[model samples]
Target: MNKRKISSLLAVTCITALIVSGCGGGSGKAEDKVVSEKDYEPYSKYESPVEFTIGRNTSHTNNLPKGDSIENNMATRYVESKVNVKAKVAWETDDMDQKLSLSMTTGELPDVMLVSRTIFNQLVDNDLIEDMTEVYEKTASEGVKNIYSSYGDLLLDQVKVDGKIMGLPMTNIGNQHQLLWIRKDWLDKVGGKLPQSVDDVWNLARTFVEKDASGTGKTIGFGMNQDAMNFSPIFAAYNAFPGQWIKKDGKVVYGSVQPEMKEALADLAEHYKEGLIDKQFAVRSDEEKEALVINGQAGMLFNPWWIGYTNYKDSIKQDPKAEWVAVSAPVDENGKFKTIRQDPVGGGIVVVRKGYPHPEAIMKSINLTTDFLYSLTDDAVQYKKEHASEGLTDHSRWNNEPTQIPMQVDYDDVLKRYYDDIMKADKAGSADGIQEDRVVSYEAYQEFKQKGTAVDANTYGEYLSRIEGQREANNPNLEVIPAGFYGTTETMKLKWANLQKMEQEMMLKIIMGQASIDAFDQFVSTWKKTGGDEITQEVEEMSSR
Candidate 1:
């Protein structure tokens, strides 16, 4: 953190505010002596703008069209434009885990670093990051002030650690909810409405199997990438959100230990026994489940809205008639299934030196990033493909594209709205990699009430992998789980595992009828006797802070 730079930044903001507000005194000609308004100066005046060296995790340099890659990629550039300062991003690395760790070890942290809560904690514990509380309170401009107030508790909790605010945490934009995507055409074939209740879903899966709605006689009733990370939506179906680790009721609990978790597992085990789950699922990477779905070998999947655009639609090019639709994930009749939201913590914390330059710059970056992603227009065409992967033998990309924002959920909304506003934009005129003449099949679906069924009318770009028929298409679904809910402290981390494993293990056991639901009581007792007390205490303390 540069002290002189801080002085300059504060001075600049003060003077600007004064000059703009002070002009009220006279005719305001160049030579007119203007009385800057302010019942009086509340604090300091603006100093000359200074230069900063920012470090980012990116794939582009800061000299492309939008602002070169750096200028365009960060919202901080908006800050620069306002403060009349310039920044030279000293380093831009794509692998945040590797780069930040390396940078921390070398004691060369960026003036501003973008990272997640876990990493932020590690950095703070190591005494490598600065606290930004004063800066936030004093320097936040009007726009910066508003966002902080809007995000409120969420923003406050993310940056605070051990009762201290250390950095500017990233915020979630767009649809931060999960939705289930199912093949309605198959549902209709099975003489069923889309499954709504958990039991209803199971019954429908059985029907699909009995009837082979896909006509291939090989459709798996359900398919999901087996990664524990991607299991939130499915877990939600059973009323569970398995964060990497958690603390409940004051004890460290693990996901696998929960009795409900066991029930969930047993449910999975049952599906496995019935061959309703993808047989290859255990070994299937995220890529595999995706490929299975778009190829029609799997009729169901759990993923974000963008999946339809980037995965299924991309793969369906191989078979033009391939169609898909999305709906909110199914719940139990109690409507109490698990719907895991982001862990209320995310992206490593970004911190500036205590009393360093542009206190509001970090906040400005967040604002800019959000607006850039959600407030996109035709002029923003440059924003897309900033770091697009060129279809080739060797994959390469840069952080120069707008679509590169992994969470640009608004794209899903805009995509549908645009295509719907004028159907011609997507009519057969340009399906890109989409299957031509699929609408003819879709029309029949309409007669049966499948209008918004084909993901998003037609696809724009498509790609397929041979390993599995996983396709990438233009139909982007915006539904995604919340971000930043994974940053529990060390003690909570321990209790969370014990708790989760208890639930996970028991879920499988009960569904197998191997353990009766009555065992849930015993499991809860075990949890309480374990470290549940400590876990809950820590979580409650964290929330209070």
Candidate 2:
């Protein structure tokens, strides 16, 4: 035999010997024999544990078990025992941006880590991360593949670097558009019809402020965070979306500086002057705003679907009668609800270090988590029982856990299936159709029978998610305009933060009557002069590419 054939024969002989003896150092058993790398599967446990280090960012809001920490949590321990992969914490921090920057400067990156899109691009440009294209295709579970496919071609295409998969994006539900959250009880009390037009919205706000819809002596027509003046659904209603680059007249243009924005600003300024919006909202936090809804100080808000867990929950707790409902943002004369949809491409992505030997480990970890959390199987049932005390059943806490690109299923699809179960139960006139996955819906339905809206926080959140999905699923009037650009352009990197601060300051001043409406004209003039024009040109270049 030639030398090449002799080498191949010897390699085969070693593998066969290991299989027969079952004494190899590798994880594969005789039954799970892998003659080559292509035979590897994500769920295959290593006979001997493999260890790697990861960098983690944490927060108090994570609600990690009392004594458990980022380095030694239930999640880490579970993966170690089950997958035979031990992820030791190389570093942990709350301020990930600063720490990640420091790591990059020192050239001490972890084996695996999650990073923002900006940092991800930087890593790609420097060739610091591994090319996961082949391994991902070979090892990704059906569930993981399906989740990524659901993001649509645009999202998946956006993550590719030179047509090679460099990182795994943390996909978000694309249909998470803003909705107008109003106090249902207040609408009933004022005998108010659902606001159908921008003018109708203004009228309702004015009436709520003038007539005290909350029935409390102290009431505000609207509750909003500091950025709401510039970023809320109100701006979208007028097609004046800020912080978005939109294609106008076959060219990319900044939405904030558009003429439509001036009109939206005028309307918002009028509300500020009329005391329709809380005077202190310019300084308020989201938490404070939610508190206003809870304490009966505000009647209307523009928020996302998940408000049930916080704003609605607190409000319902304080006043059992305080019912809330979500409706689409008011429309224009053309009956178009001009809402600005987010760029389908998400921000967070998980990457493996260039030198790491085990890119497949990330895929394996993802598959295991997917099986534990999503699969409707006996394993998941057992997992639930095992970690019930640690709040494993509450998937919201899963975000805090260590894993690669946490969710392996589309969030909206998960909700849709739960909605299906709920609807099935309703039609059957029995709760048997309700599945374990529909925790919020199931819990809410049970409490709904005893106390109705008095203690229906979980149900309300799930209800809102389902209702919003149904509303947006086929609504032609809902204009789903994509942001022309998502990441920072070259000029933007130099001046965007300053420009945002100036815009926020100028808008707040105009709203508070400290500056004239004409200031907007000056602000736009300055904005274009100071890098905005260059940024637009850059965005045009990027879009063309």
Candidate 3:
């Protein structure tokens, strides 16, 4: 119920996407003069402003300055001023998938939209999105192009159908694997070293609960929500990647049904039965699970590096003694911390409606925004300085842009840069070559060092996530296992929901001691009989292509 809790939940969800011949919509004239590829420029400003309607997918908190709306924020104004393109918000909603489904049913779509992978494929199949192959090549800035290329063909290839790029895929920030986050203070009090293996993690959690390290009788050893337990570090320790399509014996297979998963589930069941995990986790909301950590009722969780920027920051604010530290942990028998690599391309792709005039405008807007945000140009550098002087750090404004290929190229490398250039440099806090966008966090790190326990929550969060959390994310012993596939198959569309529901129910039941470990085998059998086999075959076929 806390405001920070809402913000943290929104932060997790905000992270996200066009048409064609055989496309679903009717052909229409260009809204502006169509320029040839030879005449195209990445930052070309149109003589007459090109206006496009956007079905904006927004976050719960825009954090805009007074009198500024999502339709006319700093990002929108910058795009219009630089590229002479006006973005009109036809409609905005936090639930883009639902809104887009309604739009598809009504046969009315905005000129542009950021859609999920499922919706993107649907739009392409319906032939309702624009082909942006030429537009991207001609109108994307060098930096934007470089960002896409950094992922090699892994990203762009996903949006390519019949060798034509149909939509722009959003590049994910790499190294988003879960890490073991534990209260260092609690571990110290409980008299245990850092956990090195699954057994060690269990012993430590048991110790924390048995000793009541939180000093509260209701202390929870491992705080987790219903679904999140599937992706916990413990599963990774057993080399089981639930919710992912993984390669096994060179065959694309569903991870949840793997033999390794049964072992992991059995371990989780044993732990749950022993009261190491939160007893009410199966029924708790995300906020309630987070409350365990934030309110000092839990000492550990498995989350990405960004947890420092979310729940733990609030925890520190409430209790300055709460010292959260991250480790790439619960190593397997081989002493390697293995984690599944998420799909590098995000869930969404940015697509323009079929027959929309000037598809190049989308690329142009993306180029301008990328250049400005990264301070790649002189004007952008000056703008960055001005914005910093104005004390504006509300990054939610960037989401207001009409079209974007949101990317953080070499994201993991940023931590290396911070370490080499800032942390271990001759000049302690000099941020000479760091990207302008990250300078704020650098400043926050400096403030955190100076202010320590008295530092504000925002400053503490930046330091924790960017510095401490990232350090663990860059662990040398971490084994990164790539997902076998990221796209949804046809069978998945019809049966994945029911299959996933059944899997979730079975996993939760087993963990809660309601169902025996043998239930996993039965669930697998039912899953295969009821479309799981078909989905796996489809996944193999797609992967082969």
Candidate 1 per-residue C-alpha lDDT over 1-545 given as tens digits, one digit per residue, 9 for 90 to 100: 11112234434443453345321111112233222332112122324443445666665332334333443334334334443444556576777767876655444455566676656665565544556675566544444445455544655666666656787654443333445566666766667776566666677777877788777878677774444435465565664545434444554444444545645655666776787766666566767777776677666765554553366665455454555555554655455434434433334455663223344444434333444443332222233334332221122221223222222112222233333423442354443323222333223323323322333423222111100112111223222333323456557556767666775565445444467666656776787678766665565555444
Better of 2 and 3 by lDDT: 3
Clashes of each: 97, 1, 15
The C-alpha lDDT values of all candidates are: 0.48, 0.67, 0.74
lDDT of 1 at 406: 23
Candidates, ranked, TM-score: 3, 2, 1
- Highest lDDT scorer: 3
Candidate 1: segments with Cα more than 4 A from true spot: 1-49, 58-81, 94-107, 122-130, 137-152, 161-164, 173-177, 227-234, 244-255, 336-338, 361-486, 491-545
Candidate closest to the true structure, highest TM-score: 3
- Higher-ranked by TM-score: 2 or 3: 3
Residue lDDT tens for model 2, 1-545:
00112234434544454445432222333354232464257566777666566776753435656776655555556666676777666766887777876665445667777788767776676555778898679878777787777656656666687678888776665546666777878888888878878778878877777788877877888765666542456787777878778888888898889988788788888888888888888777767776788888787877666666555566776777877776676877778766655655554777887656566777777666666665344665577568767643335633535443343345434445555677677667676545555555655655665676765566655555554434443355666776676677767778989999888888888777888888999999999998888888888887777
Better of 1 and 3 by TM-score: 3
Instruction: Give the C-alpha miss distance for residue 267 in model 1, angstroms.
Output: 2.0
User: Could you tell me every candidate's TM-score relative to the true structure?
Assistant: 0.62, 0.84, 0.87
Candidate 2, after superposition: displacement of residue 97 in Å?
A: 3.0
- In the range 80-135, model 3's lDDT, one tens digit per residue, is 88878877777778798899877765556777888888788766765667889988
Superposed on all Cα atoms, the candidates' RMSDs to the truth, in angstroms, are: 11.4, 8.6, 7.7
Find the number of clashing residue pairs for candidate 3. 15
